[model samples]
Each structure stands twice: as structure tokens, then as C-alpha cells.
Target: MSPRFQCKQRGAIGLMAVGVLAVVLAFTLLVVDTGRLYLEKRKLQGVADTAALEAVSRNGTCLAGLSAATYAGQSVARNHFVVGNGNTLVTQCGAVTTAASGQRTFSANPALSSAIQVVASKTVTTSVAGGIWSLFSGNSVSLNTVLTATAVAAKPTPTLAQLSIKSTLASVDTANASLLNGLFSGFLGGNVSLTVAGWNGLLNTNISLLSYLDQLAINLGVSAGNYTQLLSTNVTASQLVQAAITVLTANGATADVLTALGNLKVAAISQAPLTLGKILQLQTGTTAAALNANLQVFQLIQGVVQLSSNQSAASATLPVSVLGLANITTQIKVIEPPQLSAIGDPALAVANPLGPNAIYVRTAQVRTQVTVSLPVLNSLSGLTTAVNNLVGPLTPVLSGLLSLNLVTTINSTLCLLGAGCQQLDLLVLPGNLPLNIVLDAGGASSYVTAYSCPTGSAGTKSVTAHTTTSLASLNVGNITHAFSSTQPMSVAPMPLVDLGIQTCHKILGIGSCDPRVPFGAGGIAIQVQSNIAGSNSIQDLVFSSTTPFATPPNVGLASTYQAAAPATNLVSGLSTALNGVSITAYQPSGGNPLGALAPTVVALLGSVSAIVTPVVDNLLAPLLNPILNNLLNMLGISLANVNVGANLTCGQTGEAYLVI
Candidate 1:
């Protein structure tokens, strides 16, 4: 052969080899792309699952975990290729408006009582593969996919838990619905009970109504001395009665009587009363007439304290038999709030201006709460109906997935969805198609709240309710207590907000100010808070100012949580565990899911008075009731079981007694 002929033969062989290599390269690229698409789909499903769970959790809502997950998924999808979609082609990412980071959304119908619905979609394009594929196939290759998942999750119920209220309280106290069973049936103790009624279904920020009560307790410690002094000097029990009677008999014209009554130094009195007890300090100057009048005054005080002055005063006519007390005037000012506002400057007052010495006492309070257990009364009752109803709507779609062996994958994806997916993808080339996702969920629960008043020292019957509010920004876990201001803090109040995403709470620390908050009402005084640090609790906040000194909160958490301390003197340190309520949760047989949880929480509390509050009958009974019985016995006052039908007198005006 000639040289030219040999050269031509070599060229032909080279062309054939190049063509063969091209085919191999194409096949390899297809396999690699297929594997990548599979991996992307799995990863997208995971991101979607995580997003849904975060959305379902209460903390995630606050921390915006779902949104974060969506953002993360979008960022990841940017690395995938966009393939031209076809009937047989699979998607890597779902049909998304844009492949931007975090802008997509997945949501469940809150209206559904049971199931969690999720819809996740994103658009991804292979930056390299599409151009190369276009060069060879004369077509652009991109990936587009839509993914959705749904879950019928069990609601989180706070029932079924064995609760223990380690308190000295006599009965269950349902102060706020988030903390009690109200029936007392769930409670276990020597003789603990509960009274659930009239719940304020509003709990925002750290201060539920019950939490507000404890906060007030701290404030009380600050102003207790001044109020005690005010009690002693303002007017003696007898003096007040005499002044009122004098004004009454004179047809409400005796200004001098009014002035004298108002001017009487509460500092001079040693005892006062609710029904039978005298909350005053009688001296040698205390006369027989004064004592007699004091008894009447005590009766009036009881009526004034117990009844909610929040409403119009009742005009009941008690038959005037044995110096009856009637038509007592009452007034009240409350700092009750549902949620603390953060729109204004952080330095404005959130509570009424309080004096360092002139503390406000809980005159009378009736708190109640309800805790609906998990898997409560009828958790599964409507299940059959709901499932049957879904059959018609889901049949066609489910049949398709099953026929294509999609059940294992699609159904699994559905189960994986916790609440709602924020991001999900199948990694298919860019395509335009509508995906339908439908979900329905249902659940049941019971919730209740209950409360009692602060009992006072020396047998006083007071059910006092006092509360105040301040402004602060709370993150996922922590909370800050600033002065009476409405400004946003430089930092998040809770750790969850600061921690980025996906975290649980260890403690719901209630706060009115920072821990190092200055005591007293000098500059929105910060009382040393409990459930966090040191203790300096006193026996009772209601005490005589001149008796001695060592302010608490000079207040303490002694008013909120408690445990029996017979072995240790609780009054000595800030460790007086004497609060009255506890909570527990129950789960339906299936699982624990918060949204489905109705009365998920069961709170245990004590309302029966013994010896803590001090408004006598107004704000406290535990302390006031005992004192009343003891004092009346000492003073020769007695109960009359005169069951004269409608015109009956059970006991003394302010005294509590069994009318047999």
C-alpha cells in the first residue's frame, strides 16, 4: 500500500473510535445524573419533613424554624440541574415559582381537627448539565418537581401524667386554664382539692393570670410595710365603723367623720378583722365602745374584700339582726393584660406606678383553670367518619401511586410530614404542572384554670388578686424584665430566638426584670426573682411595719411554687416552696402532637385558705379565716345557727362558721 492510503485508513479508524467514546460518555452522564436526582429527592424530602415538624412545634413558630428550613432547602437545590420535563421523566425539585432561597412555603389547615398537611416545591437547574445536553440533543435539560406530604398527628395532651402539688394549700386552685384540672379528681394529697370556675382564657408572654398573681405577691412584699402601717394609722376597726355610722345617721353629711376616718393612723392599730378576727393592735386607749364598733367594722371589711369590686356593687338587703353589715362600698384597679406589646419604646411603663412603701394587696381573688388531658373523652370517636369521608377524594390519586409502586415512597413521604413542609423537591427538569395536595385533621381536648386568694397572718380570710405588667422581648427560651418601658431589648429575651432554630425549652422562667433588679419601687424595682436564684422569703408579706424589718423581693417565689419543708424552716431563707398548683399532660393512644391536643394540660392547685394571704375576707382566707375564728372566740363573739329561711344570720358579719 502507498503512504497516502495508510494515512486515510488511520483517519477513518480515529473517527470511529471517537464516535464510540461519545456513546459511552453519554450513558455515563445519564447514570450519574440519575443518581444525583435520586439523592436530591431524598434530601428534599428530609428538609420538607424537618420544616413540617418545626412548624408544628409552638417554639418553632416563635423561632420561625419552618421558614428557616425552607430557606436552607432552597439554597441546597441551587446546586441541581434543570432537565426538560416529560410524561416519563421524573422531577428532582417540585413545580416552584422560583428557586430562590426560603421564599417557598408549606402549610397545614389549622381548621382541620386532626391531620397535618404539607406542600413542598422548588425549582432547580443543573448549571452545567443543561448546556452540555443542549449541545448534543438540541434540547435544554432542566429539573422541576413538586412534593407534598400529610400526617394525621395526635394532639399533645397534658393529661395522663401523675401530678403532685407540693404545697400547704388545702384545695385545688385553678387560677389559669394552662395549669389545672379544676375538678380536683386528678390530684393526690392528704386532703387537697380544687375549685375551677370563671377562667380568663388569655395567656400571653410569661405572665398567665396565675403568674400575674405571683408577680403581685412580690410587689406586695415591697409595699407590705407601708400598707400595714397605713392599716394601723388610717382607722381602727371600731373607729371606722363609728365614723361610717356617724355619717350614715347624719344622712351622709358628716364630712368630719369622713375626714377623721380617712385620717386615722393605721399605725396605731394592732388588729384588723374579716368575719370574727380583729386585724388591729388594741392599746390601753381601746375602749369597750371602740371594741364593739370594731366588730361591726370587721364585718364590713369582709364584704368589701371578697366580692369583686370589678363589677357594680350589689344592693342586697341583709335583715338588720344583730348589728348586720350591708351596702359596703368597693372599688378596684387592675393591671390585667393578655399580651405585652413590643411596638412602643422599651422604656415606657407597662404597669401602674407603684410606691416603694405603698404596696397594693390582693383584696379578693377567684382563680380557676382547666387542663384537658391527652387522648381525652372522645379522641377517636370521629375517626371512622373522617376516614370514610376522605376515601372519595383520595381514591383516584392513591390508586395511581399504589399501581406504580409509589406507595412505599409517596406514602412514606406523607407519613414523614409532621405538620407542613417548607421545602421539598423531586429534582425533575424544569416543567409546568399543577400538583394537588389535600389534607384534613381533627382532634379533641379539655382545658381549665383555677385560683385562690392570698391568706393572711393571724386568721384572716382574704382571696386577694393583684397583677402588674411590664414590656420585654422574649426569644425562644429566655425572657427579660425591664423597667416599666415598652422598648425592644438589645438582645432576645429567650435563648430559642438567639439559638437560631430547632430547640426545646427547659424552663419557662417568669420575669418582671433582670435578676440583679434593684429592690423597692425606686426605679421600677427589680425584686430578686425565684425559679432562678437566691431566697429571702418572709413568713408573710402582710405584717405590721413597726414590728421589725428585712424586706423580701424583698419578695420571693414563695408565693408561686412550693414543697413541704417541715424539716427546714422555710421562713429563714428564700426557699419557701409554698405555691399551690402543678400541671401534667396526657397523650392519646396514637402519639403526642401539640396541635391535636385539646385539653392537653392538667394543672393541680390549692385554693382552700390556711395561713398565707391577709385581706381577711377581701383577699385572703387561709390566713384570715383561721385568725377570724380564733379572735372571735377570744372576744366573746359567737355564731348563731338561726336558719330563719331567707332572713338568716349564719355567723358574725365578718366571721366564717358552719351553719348547722
Candidate 2:
């Protein structure tokens, strides 16, 4: 019983041992082969990633001479991944598009190469498990299998471009300084006093945009390097000024400039909160390095102050005085704030320079209204005498043109008594009359229309911008209501004179005359309305290496609106307006009383135009021309000309990162 049982148990134990050995060998091969494949895959993935990143970082393109494939091959070689030795590396150029939901998609485009894609593959022996299956099934399966790894890399930041708009005012004089002070004071709702030197310092000084933003971020307690948030954040005018002061102080600005800035800061306290994005526009995904451009201190301050003013209820009052006029009040309001500088992707801007998403900048749009109280004719003995001498001879002619019995009736009825006689008096311009002159200046605008960065040299970089100069309109009349920044101002005929009667009462043996009463109901109101057309034009601004981001170049754009042939005869428009004076006759209630006297009134106006034109020209030319020109210059607005500046940096080489 024992011998046969022992023999069977030994055989069974040997069979079990052989089976366990085979299973252990198979499991070991599977583990080793799988681990080797995994390691190879990992290595291949590393090579592909490195190749893609190198291709993009080197600015590789699919265009003719330098190809992304060539760059990727070099990177693969450096990584020790040999090609054609059971290993292959393929590269393709493409662009990365990001959706609004933050989803990224890659599209292969040979024409555009914003990103590079690399595929690395190696042919390796089939897995042990498959080999075993093939052996069991008696089928001839392939020995080698392809293992591929793919990677896509692109520039972390986009191609950045910056444009700056500067004021045409290169230097400041005492007169300009005074005007600037009055303007800024009016905008800030406080007093702003700066000397000519101080203003000139601001105009000449330049501030680094990056440094200013950095300091501003720090002051605002925003996270470092978060320029997008900093730009969109709401900040007070004082904060913006202080940030500029800090940057200027670090750059060692003149004491006068700093002091002036300090004064401006104090004045800016009354201003409302505003975002820097209004004045300085930065497109989405703009890199921090692109903000290294420079900005003029005057332009920056002016833009910020203008933005503040646009949001505030305050209006600027210009300190100007015209001869022969009393209570001269001038008010200026900003209709739209200026976009002083912009940084963005040139590719996006190229589609439409003035589109909502494009990189564009513009000067402030402003409206200036001047109200002048006409001199009291009776009070001014000399002016009254002069006016009487000029218009007294035309009274009989005016009576004939009016077709009224004003002279006869007054001579017969009033002079019949000779005790309390009433006399008809001809007043050219009555007292407490207002003469309003409104000037609306549309600011200039500039935007990047096209740009190119040559593959090889940075010197050949070129950027083009389309600029449109300002268009302005002028109106001379009487406006009853206050000026508005948002709504358009309407002009009504300005009352120039009153043809009326004066009644005298016998008192203490002396003839005393009451205030002059208008004829018919009161008097005839002679009003004049004048309008001047605005001129604007479009031009191209080409920037080259000479106008780099460090130093911007300015170009003056002359308006297409020709001001007479001589160009200096700006008063010719006034003359034209005065030539077309319209005489209006009003009855006691409302309607015009003179039904058929329009043609006669026109003839009368022709006669009176010669005399009134000179007086008006003399009175207004000296007063309005200087004020308008000086105000326009200081406000960065012009009817005849505009100054625009431009700066462009194609893009900087940034770190490459995987996008897909």
C-alpha cells in the first residue's frame, strides 16, 4: 500500500512544480515588458515636449527658409532621440484658439504658425501577452508595434503691441500755463496753480508705463503682476497722481514738476473714482513685459484728469476777458475722456483698428461755451455815441423797410403835447443781452491698422496706424439754458438791438425819460446766428525702429478744413456770418408782425452789415481768437490741426509652454 501511493504523490508534486514555474516565468516577462514600454513612452513624451517647446521658443515658423520641422528635428537630436532608427519625430505649425469658456483648441495652419505640434514615435517589439496569444492561436502576428507621443507648445503670451497718444503741446509758456491752470482747476473743482517751468517739466518728462503700473498696484494693494486687475480696478484721481509722483520721484524728476504734481494731487481729491482702463487700455492676455513703454507725464495727467472730469459734475471755467463786454463767463466740459495709451495683440487689432476689441487711442472730446454780457449802451457814453452815430442815420431807412408809421406816429401823438412827449430811440444793442459762442471740438483718434515683424532682424519691424484728426463745429448765438456735456447745445438768434420808444414825464421842470419800450408791443428784436463748419481728415502713421517703445515720435496732422486761403484769416468765418445777418420782427404776443417786410429787412441788413461787421469783428476777433486757440491747444483739441504720437514693439521672446 505504501510503495504505489508514494510514487503517485511524487509525480503529482513534480507536475504542479512545472506548471507553477511556467506561470511565474510568464508573469515576470509581462511585468518587465510592460514596465519597459512605459519607460520608453515616458522618454518619447519628454522628447516630443522638448522638441515642441524649443521650436516655439526659437520663433520657428512654417514659412519658406526656417521651418518648425527643422527646429523640432534639432531639438529631438539634442534630446538623443535619433530619427530613422526605429524612432521618428514629426512637427507641424498651427495656431491656438481659446474659447470664451477657457477651452483651448489647436488648429493646424501652414500659413500661420503661432504654435508648434510635435509627434514622436518609436517601433518596438510587441508585448509578451500578445505574443503568447499569437502562439496559442497559431497565428502570425506582427512583431513590432508603434508607440507614439504627441505634444503642442506655444508662446505663453501673445504678440504684444503698444500705442501712445501724446498732446501736440511741446512746450509751455506763461500764457499757456495760466490757461492750463484755469482749465485743470475747473476740472478738479479746486485751484491748480503751476508755473511755466513746472508745466514744461511735465510736458517734457516721460514716465515708464510698467513702473507706474507696478507702483500703482502696490498702492492699491493688488496682487503683484496682476496688471489686468489693476487696470480695471476703480481708483481715485489722487491715487493715480500719487502713483505717478512715486514713479517720477524714483526717476529723479525735477522738484518743480514734483511740486506741481503735488498741487495737482491736492486738486484731484475732489474728483470721482475712475478706472485706469479708461485712459490706458490693455488688451486681454497682454504680457507684463509689454507694459515697458513710456508715456508723457503731461499726457498721462491730462488724460486722467479728463477722465475724472468726464465722470464728475464739475465744469472748467476759463479765465478770459474780452474788451467792451462785461460778465464774460466761459465753461468747458469733457464729453468723452481720452484714451492716452493702448497695449494689445496686433493680430487682433489688424482686423479693425477702431473696433471694440482693437488697440486704439483718442484725445478728449470737449465742448466750450462762452457767454458774454453785452455792454450797457446807455452806461458806455463813448460806445453809445458811436452806435448812435452809426445807426441813427439808418433809422429813417429802417422805418421805411419796416413799413411802419413809427416815426410819424411818435412825432404827431407824443410830440403834440410837448409836455410829456415820447421819443423813438434806436438801440443797436440793449443792456443785459447775452452773446454765446459755442465751440465743439472732436478729439483726434489713432489705431493700429497693420503691423509686421520680419523673421530675421528686429530693425525691419514696421507698424502702421490710421489716424483721424478732430472735426469741430462752432456756433455763435444766444443759448438760454446751461451747457451740457452729454446733450447737444442748440443755438437761438442773439438779440442785437431794440427799436423802441421812450416816454418822458415832466418832473420839476425837467424832462425825465422812462426806460425805452419796444415798438408795437415792446420792440423789434434783431438777432444774429452764425455757424462755422468743422474740418477733419484721416492720415496714416508709420512707425519704424526710430520710434521705439522707449521714445515715441509725434506727427502733426493738419485738418482738411481750409480756413481762408491765407490760413491766418480765421476771422473770415465771422465775417461770413455777419454778412448773412437775419432781422426778426416780433409783435406783442408772438408771431412776426412784418409780413411782407422780409425782403426790405434783408436790404436793410445788407446796409447795416457793413457797419456792424467791423464792430463785431474788432470786439470778437481779439477776444475769441486768443481764447479759442489757447484753450484748444491746452485741451489737446484743434479745429485746424492735431498732433499724434505713436510707439510700437512687435513682441518680445517669451517662455514657451504647452497649450495643447
Candidate 3:
């Protein structure tokens, strides 16, 4: 080749060689640099994970939050490559700390951010082909080459979330529901909860169950706010109901107990859980539970109340007058102490003394000793003075729940207010009262009149009570025979069993017109014959007196009640009411009153309205207003709707009230 042309060709060859060298160098560097970067990243990431897990395990609550951030930083920086180059580069990194949130969001701190990072420097060197070729042109053996490389290693935003935040919320919702169901079942005496298994142990591993229970009672007022939110959890209606029941039971609320129960039943009936098995299980369980669990599905009660519409029952716009507010379902201890605001009418013992009741002075400074042998109470009553408080609506249907054995265990004295009495049927024979009483005075067991029944007229009997008493010996004999001449048994089934009117024979539970006892929308005409001169005793009874079942032709409403009134002895007034179907008298058997019904006084009271006050004339006492009483009784209404001074005082001494 020519010298000049040869030189140009050689230059081209060398240029091509240099380009190839550059290409190979770039490929090699790419592998080494990327690999180094990856390794460094892994190291930093592992550090973050370690520290974060430590903090989490420790539950750094004060900074359960702040520790998360610290952990992330610590993890990201734990490993590093200080490139011999004074320059240090960290691109991205991240770390996790907390387990979960109220929303079930579990992740390390800055969940999506890089927690650590590091970078390396760069350098380049010439290739063998370039150095050799340059040796021939100049005295130089090789040529210098420069290359730059930069490495960026960092944890990137998480493509995968450790935990979904929404999941946390879902979990909380579930847990809360379980807590609720568990509490409710426990309160109502149901089987121990499967969820709150150990909770049934009746002992808080952390504290005494009683202490917890007491604390719950105290904090209930405050915790109500926390619990109220639980009610609004985004769950099905049935689930919500279950939670509500649990919370209320755990809290031991008095007023809201029934209300919560009723609500649960209602939710069960309406929007049941979507889970079919759960729904069926709940239904069956509730059915079984209600047999023993009387926490009262207040929700169902509300439903029943809701059943009332703008309609009339026999022309009377129905006012939902539940007999009592407090019921027997709750234990008596759960009955909050009475406040004066609870007092109302019917303060006397008569006219259904158990209801429309009033509190009278029992033997204060009383000894707790029951018999000389066994005492009913543990400690003596230091009742030198009492702070009278009236309260109650807890009636038999809900309150006085009998034990499975049909036995009632009571260590405390029963105290009720006038409002309580208004709900009780006192005039009923034997009364709606679930107790027996015995009065004592005048050196003998006496039946002193505490007060006459509001709805009933007072009847007199010739009672001869002895006044002489002995200290060593208690004169506890029949005191009725002292007043007039021959005392006869006073309380019979008529005014005692139920406050109503009936035919003389019907009240006596025999020889009545209807061959069978009748109930529901029926009437009776009771009678009394003052056969006191020779007759000895008279009695009456009150029963369901249900009407006889019959075919369509015989289907009719019958006042399913039977009552009677009879008199003898020094009885005063005698008359019939219910258009002359029933009778009333003052005395039992024996003596007779000296005069007719009191006229002047009767004129003032205006026709005596189902009741006749005797003119000092004891005979007329029995025969007062019979018709008006039956009419009132027929209505199945009480004097509560109207305003009146109703006072019913029940006094029981030894042998005061005897049930045969």
C-alpha cells in the first residue's frame, strides 16, 4: 500500500477496534454494577426488617407510632458501601412496625416507602487493543481511558402491601361482635360462650369477676359512649343486636336491660344474619334461651308496643298502660333503691293491697332472728329509723320469677310504693300478692283494718278480740270474736281473690246460674243474705273461670271471672248490684246492724258509685255498690287513668293473712 493511503487504512482499523472494546467494557460494567447494587439493597432491607420487628414485638406504645419511623430509618442505614469515592448515595428504602390498626392495617412504618439505600462510585480503564496500537505511533506504550459508573440502591415503594388497611377495620368489626354476643349470653345465664371461653370461669385472670362486674357497673355510664359506637358497626342488624345485648349485659344496666333484650329479639325477627346456619341457630337458641334467659328481648317488647296503631279497643283509644315498669325478670338486688318520685295512689291495704301499694311502718329496730332456732337474716336490723323510699313496677310477670323448683327465696323485706300498688290487683280474693300475712294486736292475732280497698266497700264482722296480754306468753289466738259477739271468718274469695262483682252463688263458687265458670266479657250478680242470727260462715272464690269451648255457634265473649259476697253475724248493710245480679254485706254471720243504709252521708258522696259506706250501720257495709264494681272490673281497667288519693297499706303480723 502507498505510505499515506496505508496510514489512513490503519487508522480506520484501530478506530473500529476501539469501538468494539468500548462495547465489551460497557456490558461487563453493567453486570458488576447492577449485582453490587442488588446485594447492598438486600442488606439494608434486612436491617430495617430486624429493627422494625424488634420494636413491634416490644409494643413500643408510647411511640407505638414514633418507633415505627425510627425503625425504618435504622433498618435502611444498617448496611452501607462507602465507595472509596468520598461520595455516598442512597436512593430509596422502607420498613414496617405495627401489626395492625383499628382497621386491621398491618405494615411497617411508612408502609409504601423505601426504608434504606446505598450507592457505589464509577471508574474506567483503557483496553489492550487501544494501548498496543498507540505504542507504534508514539513512544507511549498505551493510552489512558476514562469511564464513569454510578450505582443507586434503595427499597422502592412496596408493590405489595403487607396488610390492607380495610382488612384491619373488618377484623375489628368481627371481634367487637364476638365480644358482645359473649357478654349477653353470660348475663342471661346461658351456656358459656365459645368465643369468650375462659370468660365463663367467673374470674378475671387480671382481676376478680365481682370486682370487674362492679367496675363495669360503675364505668358503664362512661363506657356507654365507647359502646354506643360499637352499636353502629357496619354489620348486619342481627349482629348489631347481638353486640348490643353483650354490652348491656356486661354493663349490668337496669333500665336498658329489657330494652336491649327486646331489641335483639326484634332484630332476630326482622333482619337476621345472612349466614343461614347462624340465623337458624340463633332462632333455636333464642327459643331455648328465653325459657331460662329472661333478659327480656326489649326489642320484641318494643315491637309489641309498635303494634299499637291509631285504633280503638271497644271505643277506648288504646293507651299502652303496661301494668308495671320494673319486672320480676331482674333479681331484686338489681332493683335500684327507690326514689320519692316513684310514689303514687292506692296507699291502703284493701282494694288489692299488693298493688296500688303503700309503705307503712313495719317493726323497726327489728331483730333478724327468724325463729328462736334459725334466723332468716344474717345481721340484726339496726333500723332505729328508716328513710322511706317508694319504688316498683317490677311485677310478677317479669320481676318475681320463680326458681326452676318453683320456690321463691327472699331474704329481704318486700317494699313497694303506691305506683307499685296501682299495678297490683289487691281486691282479688287472696289478692294478687304472692305473700302471706298475719296481724297481731290486743293480746291476740288480730285482723285490724289498715285501710279499705279503693275499689271495694268495707264489710264488718262481729269480732271479739281479747285485749289482755302477758309478757312471758304471747296471746296469739283468734281476736275476731271480741268486738261484737261471735266473730266469723272475714276474708273470702270475692273481694279478696279479685276485685269484681258476681252472683251470690258465683262468688261462693257454687249454685251460680252458669253451670261452668265463665271468663272474658261476662257479668255476675253476687248476693249476700245477713243470715247472721243462725248461719255461721260464708266463703267465695275467684278463678280463671274460663268460658266453655264450643263450636262456631257458641263462639262468644264471656267475662271469664267469678266472684261472690255473703255476710252474717253483726253485719250491717246488704244490697245487690249489677242490675241486681250480685250482693254485698257488712257482717259475716251472727249479729245484725240496728239501722238501714246511711242516707245523709250517702247523699254527699253522690249515689255511692259502686260502693256504699255504712251508716255506722255495719250491716250496709257488705251490701254497698255491687253493680258499679262489676262494671269497673269488667273494663279490666284500674283507677290509675283517673286522679285519686289511693292508699293501700298491707300490715301483716302473726297469722294476719291465711291462705286455705
Candidate 4:
């Protein structure tokens, strides 16, 4: 029993040990293969993630020269991932689109480079369990498995962009300086006195936009680096001027500029509060560094003052003397304030430039009414004498046209006593008359329409914008109603001269009579209305640097806009109006004094035209042209021309991250 039992037990023990050893060996092989596969997958995933991030951060594009795949391959090589021979790395350029429900999807586009996607795969030996099964099955089977990883990354939406709108008044001479002083002084509701040199200094000075915003934030007690809040804050004109002073002083502005700014600041003390956002538009998510552009001091100050005036209740009044023969008074009201500059993300603007959130800028809309008082009409005696001489010779013709014997009427009235009577004297124009001219300038506007970032070192960066110059209207006539800011002026023919009869009594060669009176039926009036057409066009504002926001340049491209043919010429307008002179007739309170002469009076208009035209031209050529032109030039309101400036900052590099 001992020998047989011992032998059987030993054999059973050896068999059990063999089976246990086989199970342990299989389990160990499974564990080792699993670990190997996991490590390979982890390495592949790392390569894909890093490659995607690197490609996006490098600003790689799918455009012609530098492609996203090229950048991703370099990154994979740097990460020690070999491609080819059963190991593959695929890169794609695309964009990540967000749906209304906030779901995101990646769309591959060879033309788009907003995002980068990478797929990395490696072929390795199959798991130990599969090889063991294949050996037992006695049939040749595949022994390799593929592991793949995918990753997508992109930079944040909305690269930075900037735009500026400039005034056409580039320089200031003595005449312009005086006009500026009067205009700004009236806008501020205070006296602004600056020398020509001081005005020119202000015009030539440049202020850093960043520094100005920084100083403004400090002045308003806003936290640093909060440009968005700073721009939207409402600050008085005095505060804006003070911030400009601080920035200019820090930037070493000239003494004359400083003095001029000081004077302006004092004048702006009583001005109302205005939002800087109204004048300078900054889009959401704009970084402080993106605002590193420059602005002309004069432009800044002018924008602020105009904005303040637009919100106020008072209108600016400027008194001017034209040709020393007429005293002209101009009342200017800003219907809408100007958008002097703007900075933003071009992506949003490209979608819809005229949309509510678009980065659009426009010049100011102004209504200027010029009232001319001819207190010195007596000084235009030459014109009056010419008109009298011309009409005196036509008195006989006028008798036939007027259906009345003017010579006989004068004799019957003044020679009642049978004494010699003086001839009938006709005065062309009265001693004093008031004339009014109104001009409505609906300034120009510009907005971003498209943009592109640099794809390579030699790639050009640019921003395209659509510009529209608005139409301007000029009215030269008599306005019976008060001027309105929102409504168009109702212009009627201005009474230039009144054709009437003068009665006198002569006694012993002495004359005693009633003064000449206006005709009860007929008078002369001048009416002129002209519309200056504008233009619409597209412009490209190029950027010199790839990363403009990093350190913005001081200046940018400037575009000048001009109206269509027959630019704004006040004298020309008046002259054209004079050519179209109208004769009006009205009945007296009782009845028509001329009875049947009304028709004849209207017929006399044709003959009077020839005489009135030359006299009016003679008066206007010498008295109105030079003065009106000088006044309009000083106001910087050319119905014909405008200027706009633009700057662009695509975005900064090295800001890419995993988005999906």
C-alpha cells in the first residue's frame, strides 16, 4: 500500500503543479502585453496633443506656403515620434463651430486655419492571449494591432483690431486758429483763447492712446487694466482734458501745446459728462496692450468737446464779418457726435460691418446756420447806383410792362401845384437787409468688412473696410421759422428788393415828400437749394507688423474722401440761386392796389432779371465769396471732403490651447 500510494500521489502533485504553472505563465503574459499597449497608446496620445497645440500656437495656416500639417510634423519629430512604416501622423487645418445649443463641431477646410487637428497611430504586435489562441487554432492569423489617438486645439476667438477716423483739417493757420477758438469756445460755453502758435502746437502733438486710457482710468478711480470699464465710464470734459494733459506732460509735450491744453481744460470745466466709448469704441475682450496707438491731441480734444456739446442743450454761436460789408452770425449745432477712433476683434466685424456689434466709425453730423446782416448795404452804393442806372433807362419799358405810365404818375403826384418836379428815383436795395444760409453736413463713415492674418514671413496682413460719405445740403434763402436741429430748414426766397412808387410834392423848386415804399403787389426774392452727393467705396488698410497689438505703431493709413462734382462752394451756390431769382406778388390788406397791373408786374420779372443779375453778381462777387469761404474753412466743415484713418492688429502668437 505504501509504494503504490506514494507513486500515485507524487504523479498527481506533479500534474497539478504543471497546470498551475501554465495558468500563472498565461496571466503574466496578458499583464505584460496590456502594459505595453497602454504605454504605446499614452505616448501616441501625448504626441497628438502636443502636435496640435504646437501647430496652432505657431499660427500655422492651411494656405499655400506654410501648412498646418508641416508645422505638426515638425512638432512630432521634436517629440521623438517616428512616422511611416506602420506608424502614421495625420494633421488637418479646420475651424471649430459652435451651435446654438453650445455643441461644438470641427470642420476641415484647406482654406481655413483657425484650428489644428492631429491623429497619431502606431501598429504594434497583438496581445499575448490572441497569439496563444492563434497557435492552438493551427491557422495563420494577423499578429498586429493598431493604436490611434486624436486631438484638436485652437487659439481663442477674436484677434485684436483697431480703426481710426480723422478730421480733414490737417494744419491750423491764423485764420483757422481764430475760427477754432471761436468754435471751441462756443462749444464749451466759455471763452477759449489760444495763439496761432499754440493752436498749431496742439495740432502737431501726438498722444499715446494707451497712456491716455491709463491716465483716464486713474482719474476716474477705476482699477488698472480695466480699459473696457474705463471707456464706458461717463466723465466730464474737464476730466478728459485733464487726462490728456497728464499724458501729454508725461510724454514731454511742447510748452505751447501744454498752455493751449491748459486753456482748453479751464474752458471745459462747466461742460457736461460724456462717455469716452461714444468717441472711442473698444470691442469686448480687447486687451490693454492692444490700445497702444497714437491720437492727435487736437483731434482728441475736438472729439470730446463736440461730444459734450452734442449732449448739451446749448448751441454754439460764432460772429463773423464778411467782406467788411456784411456782419455774419453762425449758429452751429451738432446733431450727432463723431466716432473719432475704434479698436476691436475683426472676426465679429467681418460677419456684418453695419451690425449692432460691428466696429464702425463715423464723423460728426452738424447743422450750421449762417445769418448775414447787411447793416452796411449803404457801402454797396456802387452796386445800387448800377442797378438804378440800369432801371432808370428801362423805366419807359417798365411803363409798358407794368401797364402804368410811371412818368405821368410821378408828374401828376409831385407837380400838382404846376411847379417843376424832380424825376422819379428808384432805389434798388434798402439800407439794411438780412440774409440766411444753412448748411447741413452729414459726415463720412467707415467700417471693417474683412481681414486676414499673416500666414508666413512674407505674407501680407491687411484689413479691408467699406466707406460711405454722406450727402450734404446747402440752403440760401429766408427761413420764416426758427432753426431746428433734427428737421430740415424750410427755405423760401429772400426779399432782395421791392419795386414800389415814390410820391413827392414840389414847391418853388424845393422838394418835400414821403419816402419810397414797397410795392403792395410785387417784390424780388432769391432762393437756392443744392444737394451735394457723396460716394461709396472700399479701402484696404494694410498692417506692417504680423502682431500689431503687441506694440502698435504710432500712425496708420489715412484715406481722404471727397464728394462728387460741384463741391461745396457757398458763393457758387448763391450765384446759382441769383440766376434763378423769383418775383412774388401779394394783395394788400384791403385789395390789389394795382387792380389790373398785377399780371403786368409779373411780366416785368423777365425784364428785371437781366438788370438784377448783374447787380447781384457784382455785390456777391466782392462781398460774400471771400468772407464765406474763409469762415467755412475755419470751421473745418467741408461739405465735399473728409478724412479717415485705420489700424489693424491681427493677434498675438503662443496663445493656443486644446479646444476639443
What TM-score against the true fold does each predicted structure earn?
0.19, 0.63, 0.21, 0.60
Badly placed stretches (over 4 Å) of model 4 are 1-157, 168-170, 222-233, 284-289, 319-326, 381-433, 454-460, 468-472, 480-488, 498-520, 532-595, 618-641, 652-660
Instruction: Mark the 10 consecutive residues where model 4 has the least summed lDDT.
Output: 555-564
Candidate structures ordered by lDDT, highest first? 2, 4, 3, 1
- Tell me the tens digit of each residue's lDDT in model 2 across 184-260: 98888778999998999998888888789878988998865567788899999899999999999998999999999
Residue pairs clashing, model 4: none
Which candidate has the top score in TM-score? 2
Residues 1-660 of candidate 3: C-alpha lDDT, one tens digit per residue = 789999999999999999999998876876665565555445534443444443333322212244433543344346442234432332222222323463322222222221222222323244555555577778576343432222212221111100000000111123333433432332222321233222222111111211222233233332211222222223333443344445555656444343534434443433312211110111110111011111112222211211210010111111111111122111100001101001112122223333333211100010000011012111113210110000111123223333322221121211222211111111221222211111111110111123221123443211111111100101111122211223542322122112121221223344333222221111111232221221112221212112242100100111111111212321121222112212222221122111111222223222222332221122222122221122111111111111101111222223111010
Model 4 global lDDT (CA atoms, 0 to 1): 0.67
Indicate the worst ten consecutive residues by lDDT in candidate 2.
Answer: 556-565
Residues 1-660 of candidate 4 have per-residue lDDT tens digits of: 699999999999999999999999978888998899999999889999999998888877765566678889999999888898799988888777677799888887544566788999999998777777888999676789889999999886546666666666767777677777888888888789999999889778888887788789888987655677887888999899999999889878899999998999888855477889888887776644456577888888888888877888777887564223335576777778888787777888888787755878777877777676665444555655544553454345435533333234322342323433323333345435566766666766778787777666666566665666544565666764434545665787666555554556666688776665565434556665665332223344443345344222322223223222224454455566546544444322135333344555466666666756675556445543443355444444444455545565556555788877
Alpha carbon lDDT at 601, candidate 1: 14
Q: Would you list the C-alpha lDDT of every candidate in the order shown?
A: 0.23, 0.70, 0.23, 0.67
Clashing pairs in 2: 518-522, 518-523, 519-522
Give candidate 3's whole-model lDDT: 0.23
lDDT of model 1 at residue 163?
Answer: 9
Give the backbone clash total of model 4: 0
Each prediction's Cα RMSD? 43.1, 14.9, 31.8, 15.4
Which candidate number maximizes lDDT?
2
lDDT, residue 387, candidate 3: 7
**Superposing every Cα of model 3 onto the true structure, what RMSD results?**
31.8
Error of 2 at 280 (Å): 1.7
